[model samples]
Target: MKFRKATKKDVQAIVEMIADDALGKTRENFQTPLPKAYYNAFENINNDNNQELIIVENENAEIIGTLQLSFIQYLTYKGGIRAQIEAVRIKRDKRGTGLGTKMFEWAIKRAKERSAHVLQLTTDKKRPEAIVFYEKLGFVASHEGMKMHFS
Candidate 1:
């Protein structure tokens, strides 16, 4: 598998994988010629050095997974950098192929390469299997996460 930063052309494949999940289907409007907002957001991320919208491709160069990794700098931990992973999704037919694990390994190495002090992520509680998968990656539930949606 090849891991690389996503180009504008990869947006549709990335969005498709995201919307394949139950929760994502509700919030993501994935369709033919996807909403312009998705491309706009991708543009913003592409311009930011600290943000990476990643894509994983197979031997045929077909997109098989996607994720967004953000490097956040803050005052806490003495000006530490934190790597946050979000919006992870593997193509429906590509799961269980070790692609997911390989992606994280890449992300972890990337965080270290960037000198990030910690790597973090937040997964919806409704996805129990996801929680377990994350645990297997050595992440601990050390803090309670809270969120408020305007909608």
Candidate 2:
């Protein structure tokens, strides 16, 4: 497997992966050839020093997974930074083959390299399996997180 920062060329595969997750009980609303407005996020990711989107590929050069890391800097924390991992998804057939673990490990390493004080991610409470996976990776539920969906 190979890992690389996402480029415009990767948009299609990324969109497909995102959409597949949405269809298979994931909450993200990504669509193929994503609406023009969504380009802002992709463009901003490249320009933002605190954000990264990575894509994983197979030997055949097909994209198989993706995840995002966003660094949050704050005044009270001084030198500390928070790396928030998000949107992690692997293709359906690739599930249960340890790809998820590798993807998460890579994100953790990258966060550490940037001197982040904490690496955190949020998973839907409904996904018990994912909660277990995160716990296996050393993540603990230290706080409650809430979201208000704008419908």
Candidate 3:
């Protein structure tokens, strides 16, 4: 598989991969379909060197997976840097074929290139398989992730 930064032309494919999980349900709990605003954000991110969004394509050049890496610089840790992975998804038929691992490895390299001190992400507790997959990738549950929903 080959990986490259996502272009505007890849938005529809990204939406499809994200909205159609292997479990047959869209990962977001909201009833409404994915919004255009969400995708527009990618436009700004794609232009920023600090934010990277990548897509994985097979030998035939068909997009099969996507992931985003956001770099954060902090002063509290004396100028520490971190990369957070988000929206990692593989097309339903592409799971367990090592594509996910390849995407992650690419993200890791991007993080290192950006001089990030750590890489992190959060997965829903309901997705036990995802938690195990993160663990297998050498991630540890170091903190209790929290969220405050407005709606």
Scored by TM-score, the top model is 1
Candidate 3 lDDT over residue span 5-64, tens digit each: 998878877877777864435444323455677567877998787888888899999999
lDDT of 2 by residue, 41-85 (tens): 789887888889899999998889999999998866786899999
| lDDT on C-alpha atoms for all candidate structures | 0.94, 0.86, 0.84
Relative to the true structure, candidate 2 reaches a TM of 0.89
The TM-score measured for candidate 1 stands at 0.98
Error of 1 at 135 (Å): 0.5
In model 3, which range of ten residues has the least summed lDDT? 23-32
Winner of 1 and 3 under TM-score: 1
lDDT, ranked from best to worst:
1, 2, 3
In model 1, which residue pairs have backbone atoms overlapping below 3 Å?
none
- The residue-by-residue lDDT of candidate 1 on 12-93, one tens digit each, is 9989999999999999999998999999999999999999999998899989999999999999999999999999999999
- What's the ranking of the predictions by TM-score, best on top? 1, 2, 3
Q: Tell me the lDDT of model 1 at 52.
A: 94
Error in Å for residue 92 of model 3: 0.9
